[model samples]
Target: MRKAMIVWGGWPGHDPDLCASMIRGWLKAEGFEVRIETTTAAFADPAIFDLSLIIPIYTMSKIEKAEALNLCAAVSSGVGLAGHHGGMCDAFRDSVDYQFLCGGQWVAHPGNIIDYRVDLTRPDDPIMKGLKSFEHRSEQYYMHVDPANEVLATTTFTGEHAPWIEGVVMPVVWKKRYGTGRVFYSSLGHRAYELDVPEIRTLMTRGMLWAARE
Candidate 1:
């Protein structure tokens, strides 16, 4: 069976474990073997690079290069990588190379928790097929992006968060090709209950499969 490995842990504020559990169930239902490890130490193994897909559920702080490179090597060789919100973007903020690989970095999401709408820029993409623009009440991330991302979906702000920036458009969902592999990321996940809803889960799960190089 193909494997889905989840590395979750950081500030509990992101509800890493809860989100990890939700992802595990989603992967299981899809018939993939799941592994959950709550530390950066899990990245210590070169063998993990052999796994089919990797899900980083943690909002990283400090990361070790040896472990981080293992991931880069794996994805460069076609192992898939995917994550949502701070778990992937905010992760390793101190490391520019990691940010380059993930394709974005979290800046200030003004007003903290706010209600926003996410629009599907490419409705036919498997990750966003059948979904429409939907409103959610949670933390809306404002990210600084890398140039290479192929944005599949976007969300607009109406000058509420940062009044200085009017009608700001943000890439809520995107994919990038790293060497022979594919990388997928969504900025939607902030709270655990977001997954309990069907539309959001559908967007996320399909993105997972897409990132798995499937």
Candidate 2:
């Protein structure tokens, strides 16, 4: 069976545990042998490299230098990495290696919990196939993204909350490569319930499968 690991914990504001449970259920349904861990120590385990995928639900936490390097090496060696929102991007504020693996870092959410639109830039991509640009109500993330990312979706800031960024477009969803591994991220799902949104649900599930080593 394909193996996957979810290491969840950090700021409770993101409901990390709840989100981790939801993802676990989804992976189980997909026939994956999923493992769960609550600490960054899980990243340092050499066995991590054996997994087919890793889903991090940790947000705004610290990771030891050795742990971060092992995690990055696993992905670079072909263990897929997939996550959403702060769980992935906003995680490890002190680890540039982690941020680089994720392809972006959460810099700001200008109008925390506001209505916005997500525009599809690569509708033909497998992860986005048949999906349409839709209206969303949540934290519209303004991230510091990697230029090498294959941007899949984006949102434009109206500057109502942070006027300095008015009209700036930010990547909402993207896929990129970290060595031989596929990395996927989406800046949606501020709340656990937000994952239930049809568009987000589709994007996340498809993105996970897309990122998994095949």
Candidate 3:
């Protein structure tokens, strides 16, 4: 079985613990030998780089230089990385290396917890296969993303909440490579329950599997 690890803990608003549990259950069902940790110290383990995949759910937290370097080295060496929302992209804000590895960083969420539509940008991609555009009533993330990301889904700002960005399109889902490793991220899932939406759930699970590089 493929080996995977989920390290979660940080901002309570994001419910990192609950979200980690959900991801752990899903990964187990997918035949992975999954381990769960509630500390960033897990990233310091030299063996972390040996795992098939790593999911970091801690948001707005600090990562030591050693931990950050370990993670970056692991991903660059072909260990896959996957995460959603602020948990991944918004994590370790002080570490530019981490943000670079993620291919994006959460900048702001205008009109927090508002109704929005997610458009499928690359329906032909396996990670987005059979998925259609869907509606979501949650924070529509405005992120600073890497130009090289292979974007798969997007959303347009209505300007109702933030007029300056009216009709501006932002990437909602994207996949990119950190060296030989596959990196997947979705701006959805501001809260655990938001993942209950079928399309959101499917997209995340598939993205995880794809990132595992199995």
Best by TM-score: 2
Model 3: how far residue 25 lies from native, Å: 0.7
Worst 10 residues of 3 by lDDT: 192-201
Off by over 4 Å in 2: none
Candidate rank order under lDDT = 2, 3, 1
Runs of candidate 1 with Cα error greater than 4 angstroms are none
Identify the superior model by TM-score, candidate 2 or candidate 3: 2
**Residue 102 alpha-carbon offset, candidate 2, angstroms:** 0.7
Computed on alpha carbons, the lDDT of every model, listed in order, comes to 0.84, 0.94, 0.93
User: Per model, how many backbone clashes are there?
Assistant: 0, 0, 0
Q: What RMSD does each model have against the real structure?
A: 1.2, 0.7, 0.8
TM-score of 1: 0.96
Instruction: Give the C-alpha miss distance for residue 77 in model 2, angstroms.
Output: 0.6
- Which run of 10 residues does model 2 get worst, by summed lDDT? 106-115
Q: Better model by TM-score, 1 or 2? A: 2
